[model samples]
Target: MWGRRPARGTIVKICGLRTIDALEASIEAGADLAGFVFFEKSPRHLTLDAARALVARAAGRIGMVALTVDADDERLAAIIAAIQPDFLQFHGHEAPERVREAKARFKLPVIKAIGVGGREDLVAAKAYAEADMILYDAKPSPGAARPGGMGRAFDWGLLNEAPREKPWLLSGGLSPETVAEAVRITGAPGVDVSSGVESAPGQKDPSRIAAFLHAARGAAGGEAR
Candidate 1:
């Protein structure tokens, strides 16, 4: 399993991509995963055609992840039909049972996002032990429509108290500059990034993507630089 041991290299992810150029940048930069948002409310959301095109362009050179927020079976089925992503990331209020159901239905590995605001939120990961991976992201502020990519960071120290049963990715407000510290503080096996590689909302800056990946790799004691 991916989470059984400490990941030697930080699993860099360049997410919220909507263009072929951006996807290519992520692959060329050696990102471990490329993400496409499916929520209509997100500025980064992609149309079915666009998502399929991006997935096709990737051509299995890198792992592809589909990001969805509280989607029902019908919507998930539609997205799965279109992209057939290598991994499914749930960034919503989905219970562990829902995560299990999605995993069984899609037969794809599930990466559940656990929003961390305080020590209490760490408990949520317990319900998702069966998930293929866990993503520890900063909790979105109250009333925020989205569950993640709010560009806010939480206390990395809180993660020290989390039991290391399952592999987890540290996310939220991670950038080229802060990723090393985030890794050092949390000792996370993997890491995920979305807005940190973007020049603006919904716009991926290829240079920033490369820089973030390089930094994350260096932080993980790799030669990505």
Candidate 2:
């Protein structure tokens, strides 16, 4: 199956995009994917109409990811119909069977997000192997309302020389200042960020976004001239 690949560096996914300006900033800054939050409880959440308008502006310039958390098929259907996203990110407690079902149902790539606080959590992969992609993120605090975008960092060392055969993304607590170090330590093929580039919850800062991409390029050894 053909999918959008990073042009020349580690994949960078800027999530929680709610505005066209931020989306354009992500594209101009050389991001590989733009993520839209569909979970209403998220401060970054956007209505389908809001997401659609912003998506139109993307216009194939970059990949788009629809992020959801334990959403039912009905909600998923609505999101798919409206956003028409290129990828689906399940950031909640979803079994591999659920991931496979979503893929078969939507015919879109599914990125299963796993929260890891320790090396033991990597075992979760056995159940998510069917997903087209995997995203490793810092585990949320107990009873935290949101699954991601919480600015928590995990031990990058856990992923060092780890046995992961599937395409994967490293996320959580990544910012322009620390992204390079995170990449160097973890050797991630891709990185996903949300609150790290924001001035406030759901608010993306353009300069931060640009600096993140530029910095990440350096980390991935694809430094832009």
Candidate 3:
């Protein structure tokens, strides 16, 4: 929740969480935020009723994030009414103008997710300064069905070459085994995981969830570059 923040270190967000066991696993493990996917195209997508229930279950224990991609105002209105999320994550090809409009309309912190396929994408991320935060995830390959949640990773070295002043979240191809290295390399203040912690697409394994959170916190405070 707003008051229950993660400790002073890297922010760890477990995204695409669907069930109560997985949700509790993240909170008990001291995650800063838990994200729910709203896109139907994703295997991890949740129905409006399901998202509402999960958000209610969080009960301010962890920051509740509603993730969407290229959604219009009418759809967002219904989602906000149902979930009332703490943050809105735009994981689509939303332009800077769209991000600004969403922030103004929702009056909530908006996290703009950029598809990082190359060094040039970092430059793209900087354009949305009006966004409350930025999320750097691997670009979905051409002809891919979705924008993200493919569990593919981009070149982490690109972030080192092009840095931004605003806080951002690092995602893509992160699991318990490689998350420490990712944090060590990028100095990302936050990290988001979806498929990496799953037993299968849309199925969350509590054990993997616990392990990822443990590994992330252990690596959070280290120096980067």
Candidates in order, TM-scores: namely 0.95, 0.95, 0.93
Error of 1 at 4 (Å): 5.8
Which ranking of candidates, highest TM-score first?
1, 2, 3
Q: Model 1 segments beyond 4 Å from truth? A: 4-8
Task: Report clash pairs, candidate 2.
Answer: none
Task: Tell me the TM-score of model 2.
Answer: 0.95
What's the C-alpha lDDT at position 103 in model 1?
86
Clashes of 2: 0
Q: 1 or 3: which has the higher lDDT?
A: 1
Q: Write one digit per residue (lDDT tens) for candidate 1, span 1-225.
A: 465323447777777889999999888888878888999999999999999888888866988889999999999999989998888899999899999899888898988998899999988888786688888888988899878848788999999987688667889989888998998888777788878888888889889888888888887787453
Q: Which segments of model 2 are wrong by more than 4 Å?
A: 1-7
Candidate 1 structure lDDT: 0.85
- Candidate 1 weakest lDDT stretch, 10 residues: 1-10
Off-target runs (Cα >4 Å) in candidate 3 are 1-7, 222-225
Q: How far out, in Å, is residue 41 in model 1?
A: 0.9
For lDDT, the strongest prediction is 2
Count of clashes in candidate 1: 0
Tens digit of per-residue lDDT, candidate 2, span 1-225: 223335577789999999989999999988888999998898999999998899889968989999999988999999999978899999999888999888888899999998988877888876786798888999988999778638889888988745567788899889999999999998788899999999998899999999999988889878543
Superior candidate under lDDT, 1 versus 2:
2
Q: Report model 1's TM-score to 2 decimal places.
A: 0.95
Question: What's the residue-level lDDT of 202 in candidate 3?
Answer: 85
